[model samples]
Target: MDAGTRNRLRARLVSLRDELLTQGSMNIPPARTDVVSTPDDDEAPLTHMTQAIASNRNRERADRLEQIRDALALVDEDPEQFGLCEVCEEPIKPRRLELMPWVVLCVACQEKHEHEHRSPGSRKHLGDFQ
Candidate 1:
């Protein structure tokens, strides 16, 4: 890739990393409350559960942000590696790169990775990253 393209992609990845960090703010523990017979009191448990779920989502987003940071490091070390498939060593499609600048695999390789490695009844494979 040219210098301009590398710079643009690097800028974009940095922007995304910042945006994700801002969005994935640490979930605050629910505040303690006094005994009260109100709708808010009745919904406290559900609210806490929602907060827990949001916290988990935020943690997942944080992990992706780490991946983006790693990709940025790789970009700095070798801009020529950008947009090239790690598995096939071919140029990844422009649209795919546009959509996911941190991607390290082409669509074909990604699909294959998912099919071969992803478990049917398990959480996402955090290792087979983009």
Candidate 2:
């Protein structure tokens, strides 16, 4: 990739890192226990469920942030490897990079990777329910 394009991608990744950090800092405070527990004490479970969902969402974002940081490191350490597919060692399509700057695989390699990584039974059962 050109120096200009690399810089642009780095800037975008930095922006994304900031956005993820800002969004992931949110939390739902625990339910209060001042009032006596009652049969209708549904607030506790509902609050717990809400907190679980938020935790999961934040975790996903955290994972993505970590990936972005790693990509930045790769770009810094080896500029030549920045746009090459990890699996094929070939230049990834510029259009694919535009859509997913964090991707480490080209389209063909990604499809093969996904197929191998997925559960065989899941794909074999596509029409069983019908």
What TM-score does each of the candidates earn? 0.73, 0.75
Candidate 2 C-alpha lDDT tens digits along 1-130: 8999988888887888888877665575656645675534767788888788878877888888888898889889998899899989999888777766777887778777767888856563312322
lDDT of 1: 0.80
Candidate 1 segments exceeding 4 Å error? 24-28, 31-45, 121-130
For residue 62, model 2's alpha carbon misses the true position, in angstroms, by 0.9
Residues 67-126, candidate 1: write the lDDT tens digits. 799889989897788778999999888777777898899888888788788778866653
